[model samples]
Target: MEFETKYITPDIKLALFEGKLFKTEVMFEHHMLVWFISGETKIIQADATHIFGAGDIFLIPRNQLATIINYPRDGKPHKTVAMHLTKERLKEFYTRHTAVGKLQPLQKVYRFSKHPLLESCLASLIPYFDLGDDLPPDLAAIKIEEAISILRSIDKAMDGLLADFEEPGKIDLTDFMERHYMFNMTLDRFGYLTGRSLATFRRDFKKTFNTTPQKWLTEKRLELAHYQIAEKKRKPTDVYFEVGFENLSHFSYAFKSHFGYPPNALFKDRD
Candidate 1:
């Protein structure tokens, strides 16, 4: 069974998901704070895999795809709390504060070390989970501020992560697209990430790739899917969504159209 609780305010979201085993992949839209209340989990980013258990807390930055594996630990259901901080809120806070300009690039994920204040802040929210969607937005904002305050005291790095709210500067389009093609987001999102407007992104993308963004994405995703299914022995159903196809049927149709055979033929030929 999949049980998820989503509590949202204008700038912050408190969420919970309970599932025994599942693989989740998505491009994060906001800065995320995650706490595991029960279960063992694996977080995969590119070639890296991070494993954690109950009582673990970590942070992830926005604009990247991640694969999360939730599995039961010690005969208990997997449960976690996730908090998302919107860019608009971060920018508002950053503009009012001047001290954050002298910070460095922050790490993508920061595992919380032992901190009494952080623990206390998390503990205070335990009772609110019972209130569910009825929890007051102002109270939720206050709690989020409290958590950020605790983070600020621990390291100057927090300031950089939270306050560096400007849009991404112009980056190499080819490099950015290659690394981020798996994310199933709109052209505008891609444009923003590459520091271009929608028109400029399309113009630049065509110049660099000699193709439209949508076409390039479809081809790239299909190529990767083919490699996984043919070389890595992965099931099309398992990797279709990860590679950015909307559903299994659509993925199969496209796969057959591209390769002149269904994906299952790979395994059939191997045998």
Candidate 2:
């Protein structure tokens, strides 16, 4: 199964996938906090069965083996907004963040909140669906940012529900990375912003996702590059630079290995 990343901002990502459910295995380099807007399915993970319905929220940590059965039929669609985040992303809001850090190996699933405040905030995100067109990048950015704010608010509220509260503010890692992924980002800097130690960040990150920070960052860049080549009609040369891949040969090799085809082949017309 293939999952595409869309509308990535500082702290969130809006992803969409329309595909038949078959027995499958999935993994993520970053944490996935999913709002299942529509669809009914049963997810089997770690020998446990989870029945999910519309309006239910599910959290899947970085690396896990799970199978989703799209009930009713395979042709039926399952739509969801998966907010891909990292512990480092949330730590930016406070000089002394502790909620996620305290709960090492946090709970992987939380039922939808009955709290009216959270319910209403989640409801507001539905309107952003109208702004999905690729045109109007400015308007799209504004709407997407608004949606991210709402998600952050919900995350705070949910964290409270779990009784793990932290500072109140938006953690805008998306803006930071847009400006700074080119520079060498150190664990010390990242930990200082999130109130974690470099050692703690590395340990928790590896425990939660089963991958190192460097590997995840590389995969994210490649994912962005793949999106540009296939969806944005971007040239390989332009995409390499745009995604901060300085070496074209490395980019091409990685692209071919990951996608099983040359970059140009992704844009070629098929019979």
Candidate 3:
């Protein structure tokens, strides 16, 4: 049995998942503050992977790519409370201060392990879960403001990470795509994160990769799938989702279409 539930307001919520495992690739639109209440999480980034167990607090900066694996541990479901620092709220908080922050290269996710203030701030929200989606706007805003204050008090960098409101600037398309192609998001979403409009993303993608994004993605995903299935001796089922195919059947269909044979054919001694 696998199910996930969220008791959420517009900016905050409790997430509960009960299953063997749950995986997702995300590029958040808002800077997210999260505290793990139970279970464990593996956050996979381009350069590093992080593990968060119960009582860990962390922040995922806006517009970063990550694949998160949630595991149910110690016979308990995976549970967490997540708060999003929205642009509107930040603007309100930092009103009359007009400053653009200079970014250091490639700022990664920030971790605050078991900080008492952050833990207290989030734990108060568990009871609010009974309100479910109807968590009140006024109360939610107050709680969010308190969290912002707590963050500012703890780290000077929180101001720059959360309050510097700027759209993503243009980045090197080739490198970005290579590292992030396995994430299954729409073309526009990919374009946004790489700081391009849809039209410009297509134009730049074509010039840099020398092929359409769709074709390139399909080929790259299939190639990775082929390497895993044939050389690494992994099953087709296990290889499929990791390479960005949504499900087994579609991966199988596309695999056969690309190689002129089914993926399972690469394996010997099939009973």
How many residue pairs clash in all the candidates, one count each?
0, 1, 0
Please, what are the lDDT tens digits per residue for candidate 2 over residues 5-41? 4453433444445664423334444556566656566
TM-score attained by model 2: 0.41
The prediction achieving the highest lDDT against the true structure is: 3
Task: Kindly state the number of residue pairs that clash in model 3.
Answer: 0
TM-score, every prediction: 0.78, 0.41, 0.83
What would the per-residue lDDT of candidate 1 be over residues 31-113, giving only the tens digit for each residue? 88777777887776654568878788787877655767678788777766676767776666556665454555463677884
Tens-digit lDDT track for model 3 on 1-271?
4665565576887888888888888888888999998999988776677999999999898888887889988998998999999889988988854434553423688899999999999999887778755667688888888998898788866677777778888999988888878777789998998989999999999999899999999989899889988878899987777778888898899989999999989976544
Question: Model 3: C-alpha RMSD to truth?
Answer: 3.4
Best by TM-score: 3
Provide the clash count, candidate 2. 1
| Candidate 1 lowest-lDDT run of ten | 8-17
On the 0 to 100 scale, the lDDT of residue 103 in model 2 is 35
lDDT score at residue 191, model 2, on the 0-100 scale: 47
